[model samples]
Target: MTCMRCGREADPPPRHRIGFPAPVKERILQSICAECWKEWEGVEVKVINEYRLSFLDPQHREMLQKACFDFLKLPEQA
Candidate 1:
């Protein structure tokens, strides 16, 4: 599979989580490749720390999800 962001050829992605709201999941399964995803993990960590986010909060989760979309350059949901 080719990475949509960097255009690098890579192996097929592993299975993802069960529930991510369809558009968010599609952004992950389609545009962001594994390598980029790994990098995004690090970025996510930083954002989580800097923003002092807690995963238990739905608002925080949404914030992180939006950050992921921005980092991946995926278009925001309409």
Candidate 2:
């Protein structure tokens, strides 16, 4: 397979866990190629946190945004 992000060819897929609390069985957290996974690994924490925050209720948006910005080392938008 090819990496979705980098377009690089991938090695054999490895087993990975997804979601919380023992993780969902038979779930593939990421199916992208290895090269893409390497790039994504650098920002995994920030990306996952942002994903979680994005799904939260609207009242938490501001706080979530702040947290995400902090994690990304980016300035918060006014």
Candidate 3:
């Protein structure tokens, strides 16, 4: 698989299914390599903490999803 973020050929990462819909999960599996996904994990934490996000709120969840898409460089509707 080719990593969309880094443009390198690599083994796909383990499934990261939390919060994402099925199509988005498939896109991630196909496009994102493990290294970039790992990097996103670190950024995800920082984003949640920096924004004081709580998963209890629907809007917060949406914001986190947006952040994930942006960080992974995935298309908005892909």
Candidate 4:
């Protein structure tokens, strides 16, 4: 199959693990090639929720901080 993103021809598709906790199974999974997966591994999600939370009346800053800390303490992959 051809990769939708890179237009490269791919070998028989291998199952991909992208979403955490629950895995997302793609049907037309040929959209991304192996090279795209390698590049995606380096992408980072920044903590930008603070700006949005500032508008809340109760100010969930403390709760949000604790959640962030707890998430960071999750077990690391071997």
Candidate 5:
């Protein structure tokens, strides 16, 4: 499928967590390509450190999620 972020035709993640939250999973399956997602992984770490985020905190996780999604150019869920 063509990736919404990269406009490349590539395979999706093999084990995408379908059970993940609706917005998260939908973006993965519908808009984000695997390569872009991997790139987002590194950026996500930087964001976490730059913001001094604790993964255990729900607010922190939410912030990270939005950042990662935005960096991947995954349009906001409607």
Candidate 6:
């Protein structure tokens, strides 16, 4: 698989365990490599802490999803 973030040939991430919808999940699985996803996992924690995001808020979840897409270098969602 060619990573969308690094543009390198590498293995795909393990699975779609996150709560994103099927289409978004499919895009990530196909475009994001395992290494990038692992990196994002680390970044995700920082983002949550820095922003004081609570999963109980829908807006915060959307914000995090946008951040994830930006970090992955994916195009904007429709």
Q: Over the stretch 1-78, how does candidate 5's per-residue lDDT look in tens digits?
A: 888888999866544533246667765877767787778767877997899998788898788778866787766665
Clashing pairs in 4: none
What is the lDDT for 55 in model 5? 75
lDDT of 2 by residue, 1-78 (tens): 644344556662344522222221121123345444344445656654656655456645555444433543334442
lDDT of 6 by residue, 1-78 (tens): 899799999988888555676888888999999999999999999999999998889899888999999998899775
lDDT of 2 at 7: 53
TM-score of every candidate relative to the true structure: 0.79, 0.34, 0.86, 0.39, 0.80, 0.87
- Pick by lDDT: 3 or 4, better one: 3
Error of 3 at 46 (Å): 0.5
lDDT tens digits by residue: candidate 1, 15-69: 4631357767765787667788878887887998999999888999899888887
TM-score of 5: 0.80
How well does candidate 5 score on lDDT at residue 71? 86
The candidates, ranked best first by TM-score, are 6, 3, 5, 1, 4, 2
Off by over 4 Å in 6: none
Which portions of model 1 show Cα errors greater than 4 Å?
16-23
The Cα error of candidate 2 at residue 33, in Å, is: 0.7
Ranking by lDDT: 6, 3, 1, 5, 2, 4
The whole-model lDDT of each prediction reads: 0.75, 0.42, 0.85, 0.41, 0.73, 0.87
Give me the overall lDDT of model 6.
0.87
Count clashes in each candidate, considering only residues at least 3 apart in sequence or on different chains: 0, 0, 0, 0, 0, 0
Q: What is residue 19's positional error in candidate 4, in angstroms?
A: 2.6
Lowest lDDT 10-mer window, candidate 1?
A: 11-20
lDDT assessment of candidate 2 = 0.42
Worst 10 residues of 5 by lDDT: 11-20
**What's every prediction's RMSD, in angstroms?**
2.3, 9.7, 1.6, 12.8, 2.4, 1.5
